[model samples]
Target: MSSISIVPTDPQRWPLHVNAGVHHWQYLDLAASTKQPQSVAEKYFLGLLTELPNLPVASNFQDASRNGFRFYQKLQLNDGHWGCAYGGPSFLLAGSVIAMYISETEIPAEWKIEIIQYLSNTVNKDGGWGLHFAGDTTVFATALYYIALRILGLEPTEPLVSKARARLLELGGATAVPQWGKVWLALLNLYSWSAVNPIPPEFWLLPDWVPFHPWRWWVQCRVVYLPVSYLYANKVTKPLNPLLQSLRQEIFTRPFEEIDFNRFRNTTAPTDLKKPLSPLLRAANVLLRFWENYIRPDWLA
Candidate 1:
């Protein structure tokens, strides 16, 4: 008969515990190094439960308004701003990570460790990470995450990095990455500026009556476009660090120089492109090119 010892009598409190099974001795040592309070664990577990009884669904405008304000109050940020969780899109994290890195923000080591742990834990059982944790594998999501780990100082030679790189290359490399992926790589100077479609800041200078005023776009699209226009107009590329140099080989199917980037301007992983490029969007890209080449400087700069 085999004996099984319960490691942390309450597993919920020690959520960061990595080991499994009847490893009481090992966990005892782990607990000695990191003392977590039972009360703290209880608090964390309670916070995870969101099954509060709902207020009666209001039929009238006044009651609904009052409830809405209460909900808003609960969602306030520490900085006095409103807070909302952004999910559904996996590529948002890539943008966020790049922005944090470029701004010279130092993420706490514990956060970095946990992020890696989460990614490793959540990766598909078949050995590939996906766009969303449950979504299908995609060049855009995989490449962005691969570069993010490298940016965080993970070695390209490591087995995990190598495996992800091989998956990316098999999906047709950086050229097959989505628009958002291209923007991130171009910002890092890993891809050519020409491969990206123009995101002209001049659009901001347009009249309200203009057919394509950027302000008319959806809020998320416009907000993302704002920084993109700023960076693109300046052709902003970070200095080539050693990590980026290694990424060149890790992300591509062949030599970086051999890639026909122009051919890939409209190319994106099928899995990542939920909405196909519209004819209107293609025409807009053509007009944006003309504006970028000839009209943007006088109006924007």
Candidate 2:
């Protein structure tokens, strides 16, 4: 079992909580908190903080139960049991920012600036970002934020972006990005919609008793997948622009014209690959591709 002491010992800096309906973290007062830092005695309240001496030495089972109850009671929070934290990952903000932008929702200026600052601060030392705060760079994350940063109005020529683009291209470019990235990029018109795997909305209409019924899957999986399938059926693409045209050039190591979108459909970086592709799924994809090309109904999409 792990203990709280196992957490890394950084100076006692406080968190700045930015709440825009959702909370975000920023560390502050590092210098002040660490300055004239507490001596070991002061930091842990010397021996007073430990229960070593006071802990019960039970003489029997009944005594042991009493001591256990006493210790457990001491551990309870003042009010209740529930608590939470932001659970840091680097990708979710891109989704929120993109959603706001697409819906034409007005983001406050402070939020926009803070979002950019957070992205700049989070860039990995190698210049690209990873899937999460501590993870190594992956095409999935790099592509998501690269597009997000652009949408937020950062120029491609900016040093952070230039460095990131170099790293992204080295990792086999945006074409090598995983399914999630492909979905977003297709929406941005940086990728062709046909290249993404199909998620037919008709699956939702399937009978509850069917073996592959949507309800049989985990609630969270089906909940997210339901809309993705609907959108995929639409084959949505953004109108072309200078930024997208530039992205097409910047994100690929190979000539864009030479890259076959269909070929890379199932390809994903080893680090970010969660599941191996099933043969059943691959066979299904072949049939779906045929349907998408010729047989699927227009109104159904």
Candidate with maximal TM-score:
1
Model 1 spans with C-alpha error above 4 angstroms: 1-88
RMSD of each: 9.6, 9.3
How many residue pairs clash in each candidate at the backbone level?
0, 0
Relative to the true structure, candidate 2 has a C-alpha RMSD (angstroms) of 9.3
TM-score of each: 0.72, 0.69
Q: What does candidate 1's lDDT look like per residue over 166-189, in tens digits?
A: 787777777878777788889888
Local distance difference test values of all predictions, in order: 0.68, 0.69
Q: Model 1, poorest ten-residue lDDT window?
A: 1-10
- lDDT, residue 12, model 2: 39
| CA deviation > 4 Å runs, candidate 2 | 1-87
